[model samples]
Target chain A: MIDGYFSLYQTRSVNERKFSNFGKTEIGMQKTGFIPAIPDFTLTPRIDQVGAEERASRFTKRSIKKESKVNGLKLVLNMIDLTTLEGKDTEGKVKQLCYKAMHLHDALPGLPTVAAVCVYPTMVRTAKKALLDSGIKVASVATAFPSGQASKEVKIKDTKYAVDNGADEVDMVISRGKFHAGEYNYVYDEIAEIKEACGEARLKVILETSDLITFDKIRRASDIAMYAGADFIKTATGKVQPPSSMPVALIMLEAIRDFYYKTGRMVGMKPAGGISKAKAALHYLVMVKEVLGEAWLNNHWFRFGASSLANDVLMQIMKEKTGVYQCASYFSVD
Target chain B: MEKEIKKSSLSVSENGIEKKISPKRLEVLKTYKIYIGGQFPRTESGRYYVAVNAAGKQLANVCLSSRKDFRDAVVSARNAFAGWSERAAFNRGQILYRMAEMLEGRKIQFTDELMQQDVPKAKAEKEVNLAIDRLIYYAGWCDKYQQVFSAVNPVATSHFNFSVPEPTGVVSIIAPQEDGLLGLISVVAPVIAGGNTCIVLASGSKPLCAVTFAEVINSSDVPGGVVNILTGKVSELSSWFVSHMDVNATIYCEKDSTVQKMMQDKAALNVKRVIFYDKINWNTDEGQSPYLIMDTQEIKTTWHPIEHIAGSGGGY
Candidate 1:
């Protein structure tokens, strides 16, 4: 069943995929009522498990020293989406997270604020009000998040509620049960509807690659989200074990690279969950540079869906400046 | 006549066919690695230095642990503090006694390692025995030091005020540079017996026994990271050991004034408790005192609320 899902990508010739984009924006093509043929869901390019893992490991070996390390650490701090999606989240907790997003180590001058503060739909208004005038965007998770097990009306309403509360970005989860059941059309139409509900807010489609399991399915899901007008593709909701490993992230990055080449639009990538270490974040940046080049290096094109990563990057920067390792007690707890 | 006798030892035949003879055997040397977080790992920097005795013969290739090694050790020590500090005092005594038992079974190895660092045979044996006895001394204090030190204050109020000692969390220690086995034990026992975890840098010139002692510690019931031992230069690691913010105290056993002054200054960074053991000899009874265990303990005082006055006739 999975092999046939990938065979669809094999059926579409590169020339045909590129010829359809003769200077037409993917969104513009949609407005003209010309929907590209749905992926055959019968075939995809098979990912070499060993080769992908080997390539991803090499990205960690490049010595990012002295100047590059400091700069990379700061960039990591800026590209973070400080997330708090707990069931016990309160208005005060969301406000505190927003404050951390803006004042990340004010002791160190000239540090950029994090890109956004991610919260649930109920807390979006509180975050939006707390982070006002800080220039940090507010992102909310919708579509029965972490597990997309809701009806279409409720899911669309969830996205609209967050967007109505001034969420700049809507992070919606793809229905994993349907995707795993090989209901590719159901998943694609659902993402397209969420994209419409998002309106002006950029939509991030979470594939939850931990549940997807294989590199081939992750790649196919990335293709599905991109064609269905997802502004960004995120790996997980920070709610699963073994979330956002390098090999799975590599497959998604390759998919983004291919999609950018075939279609004129560029889709951003976010490998969230389990990315808490400063050194590991730098390695992810190395993977982005190697796989998708420099275009996806900034907050506009890439983001880390993390909360703890901010403190680690701040600590590394402090270690560079002060020549001493930092204790977690010194940093504020989220 | 000498050449004929030497050839006969090999038993070469007159027909030019060599008779069966044993090949000369090669002696294998041990590579002494540092212990961190319960596992024996080579120094992360992959650097090593040759340790030699006073006679100028090489003893072993010891890990030249870098500041990064100290950093890793501090992390392990910090991670282990919670469980080790909260353990029942009697259980901690049992574990320390278990360590002594492990050392007793391996005294010959410890004695040999001490002798390899230039101590005479009789002195080496004596030092090993002293080290084992010191472990027992600390094991007994593990459960009794609080009773001797704790007191109830006579406050003229309804509240009852009392103070007791608690472990001072992770400690960074530089073991004494003399009598390799006994000196390391003297410093380590007191710190851990008080319920604190520590990362110790063994004697630079005499490091063989430190690694062997780590082996003994691994087999004991004492948890990993409770006592991490690193073999490296004191000059390179002293500043990092004292200045780490997470370390609650710093112990320097040597009497070098400049390093002592430096440790005092750097310890101020985190207000770490700095201890000096420069003038003491580990082999004496002074080294086995219960006061050594009190050095790394914090005296916590609490006031209990009472519903009745202490001496009122109708209060009871």
Candidate 2:
């Protein structure tokens, strides 16, 4: 009975793939007649608020259990951008967080290291030195993160400092005030300039979705960032409440999918902050798989920007192995 | 003449035609759900067992809770521990007393549930009353038990040493099977009165009163998750309750030696405090004691060094 249901689901998704291709072609035809030198940011598609929310919620209801759940959890652990962004962040704290990223739980053998350790520009050198030869990347949040209230020159210098300090990736926040004021070109130009300043580092544009209250704005911000040469579109800066909700993530993922169809370029998606549970992490994975398909399932294309999510995932993995619920005291605090 | 006229009116319709009346509507039976985190939820497993009286009549459908339910309850209990253990001892006493007040108001309901489980009318009433009194008993002990148990020691050296009882954190309990209401109350009241949260597995056969008691705890000033109760079989859930590393203690109130051995063996993994009350009769005075509260508490000893007594000889 389960096999039959899966077969039916498989066929329906195949048909959806074809239908989406047809829709993409129609949008392409509509754009060909009046193609301009610069892409029109205002032409970005508006999001269906209720439909996106319903689709996002459906991913959480999929019961991935036992072996499949373990695999999903491991993938989630691997895709984590283990982050520690604070004003008091020091070399010692960065080293400890780097150690945690590498050795999540040495007691459990064969566990995968996280994709990267995220830190501030000043801590990038320390993180790079500590994570040397560990196959872990160091991502730095720049462009006046959490608030893009500084001058563009300062933001460019911040990006340069991180890149020069050996940051493999740069997470930059978009100016929400400008975006909210309908200055799409300004936000686009800022991301493009930051992308250039990043040199060889991958640029992750943080939309700070809490600042953009509506899904339409989130979708437009996603489009502006992607077209402006962001390698990844992130949800928040970890300093905001109501951050990185699944619906916001769904809108972003849908934007990635549509961009992939329109330009055939894949921009990664990162839903950072407020997602700390293993189950919630798995739900995000499920959302990525269904919306963007299997090509974007790896850490290179998807990431979780979080601080405490590593411990929760490790605790769950241990529980699965030992059949005993674990306590937080037994795990490291870093 | 008035009675005849009313009967005719009842048989007649609004249009003045004679109509056949239907029987009275049957009341809808309440679905018994598991209580966790201060909210009642059906078991995530969606499996239930038919609870039957001793006469083989089906009483109600009780949730056949799975290990996941116990895990969730433990999570809730652990989350609630910090706030609950930090409350003033006198405040905890007042909350337990409030639970007693709620239970007293629902005495007849509990009595009916116990009678459904085949207890005699007088015995069921006595059990309900004892359950209420048990809460009050623990309520009075909440503040005083620490004074009775703690010690201030005289040291040979110039040091001050003292030992005080602290809650041992989250406790998991497999309630007694036979004496459902009173036994459950006897075990749970003391644990929470001493400021430790617990996840209790109610009696498998006689689970009605236990779930109803959860309702009582819910309405009382007692915070949510301080006393989560699950209605299920102990045989299936005892290992989970005992082996959870986050549970600071385990209490088993069954005569099954196999389960007792398993509890001890699995509890060794976390070195959890495992207490068995298999032989105690709930009706006897042996059921109530401050020691029961002590079973789920840990003693912390502190020593403060002082200047040598000879150095303070000026005062002498």
Candidate 3:
């Protein structure tokens, strides 16, 4: 185990170049990625729970209005990973969802297609086929998905199946039980193995922060995922209570920001679940702007993992266009 | 006398001592807001009109609800439609009766509001009594109106053909210009009693009792959004109330011919049912009927394949 750590550190140092241009940056941290050391996981920085909540709430007060509001709404629509993760989801449902993903609102022209369509592993092939050439990616939740109770071999197989079947992105859940048991190495190695299994597909690691429970645990888990080769750190599985709150999102966004500063590589953030309103989605956008800057504003770096958010943002766009409140009855129910 | 107040403050002697009271000790005036989804939300437009009496005394600041307010109320009504329309007929009757009970309990409050709108003492009392009685009348009809209106069609085939009344999803109404309490109740009772939910624009000039009636609904078992009351100009809101795609029916009780023409034209956009109750005197027998309930209900004719067993034993 010691030899494995040393070899990994040596290869990492040889491959890494100097991380530049962040010397005079704010929130000063001068940690170089090519060090002969990996920081201890137990000593990850503690979060001021009260202060973090207050800061997260402050993001909501920024009044995004008129032209900017309309633009923000469109951005929110564009950034959504239209998701349908149900036990009863069928091929027909996936096809319909993919169609909705492509044509968000055909009545309103010049709208961008959503970032992606996220589904369970079994539906990846159908989603990929339906979404072909539409510029919308097909993301599959693997590694036993919402509950990561399966073995490592089973998880790898799950991810390979989704990838082999043409999923553009792979979303995986971490072993929270293992993490809570202080087996950080096991959690870290599992993520590393899944990242390898993903091959060319981008991997979004679901921390399932609702299960993590505390800010400290969330922050530490975020550090572990980012270090273990996660392409994006997502908030929840959409099946938990209090799924992806602003504070939890804030902590994750902060983690992504810190990771970028330290390694000079950008990772995406998807705050999935419980974010169904265009107004709240815009607030999330505003938080991204303030914390992660304009570079992360695009769908490439930031995405909303939601199903119902697309329609609401469409309604808001139409309200701006027609000068009347749009009804949900008028919109197609997916 | 200094008792003639400015704004809301009054000068009164306390314990026979002439004490100088601060303006902070002013009489609290009620803020009459629009009711949507069972909550008293100020109009999203942030505009209000001064409702004055026949003596030209300013009664209160009533929310001059805009089209957005109407839109929100329609949304609330549509959301409530599924649950309310699916409720058992007897339970709907129970809720309507509960509404009447709450209104009876607040009879004095509504009567005072009617009097404040320049109604004579006897007339205001009568209006309150009539409103309560009308609610009870509708409550009684809630479970029975269907049997009266539904028909077992005589079909030539072996299929059982029947036409039953279902609550049209959402109804928007421009209530009467007079009879603030009674007119609202007369139109609103029959509509809701039929299991439909509605957004009603109360009598513009005398809307105090409508706001108070919303209070009665809030306290009653009557679900929120079943009957949302908005206090505003009918002219300003009637077009929106009818033109809304979500509203199944539009009821206008005003006699303005031009407005009626505009409403009919706009209501044609969605092929919505437009009802004009302008000729009905709510105090008379013409006001209460199962037909009023049928105004906001849709006749669903179902053809089920079964032995023709209908009307074989009924009324035998």
Model 3's DockQ?
0.31
Model 3: per-residue lDDT, tens digit, B46-129? 999999998889999999999988888887888898889899999999988998899888888888999999999999999899
TM-score order, best first, reads 1, 2, 3
- Clash count of each predicted structure: 10, 0, 0
For candidate 3, what's the RMSD? 7.4
TM-score of chain A of each: 0.91, 0.88, 0.89
State the lDDT of candidate 2 residue by residue for B73-113, as single tens digits.
Answer: 99899999999999999999999999999989988898888
Off by over 4 Å in 1: A1-38, B1-28, B311-316
Better of 2 and 3 by lDDT: 2
lDDT of 2 by residue, A1-334 (tens): 0112112112334434433323322233233231112335555566677888787889999989989989999999999999999999889999999999989998999999999999999999999999999999999999888799999899999999999999999999999999999877577768777887887799999999999998878888988788667889999998988767999999898878877766677899999999999999999999999989999999999999998998999899998898788988889896
**Model 1: per-residue lDDT, tens digit, A1-334?**
1234234443346535633432333453466354554454435567888889998999999999889999999999989999999999999999989888888887799989999999999999999999989889999999999898999899999999999999999999999999999887678778888887887899999999999998888988998898888889999999999878988889888888877766667889988999999999999999999999998999999999998999989988988888877777888786
Prediction 1 TM-score vs. true: 0.91
**lDDT, candidate 3, residue B53?**
94
Question: Which one is best on lDDT?
Answer: 1
lDDT of 3 by residue, A1-334 (tens): 0112222222333323322222221111122232122345566677889888999999999987899999999888889999999999999999999999988888888999999999998999999999889989999999998999999999999999999999999999999999999988778778877877887899999999999999989988998888777889999999989888999999889878877776687889999999988889999999999999999999999999999988889888887886655668678776
Q: List the residue pairs that clash in candidate 3.
A: none
Best DockQ among the predictions, by candidate number: 2
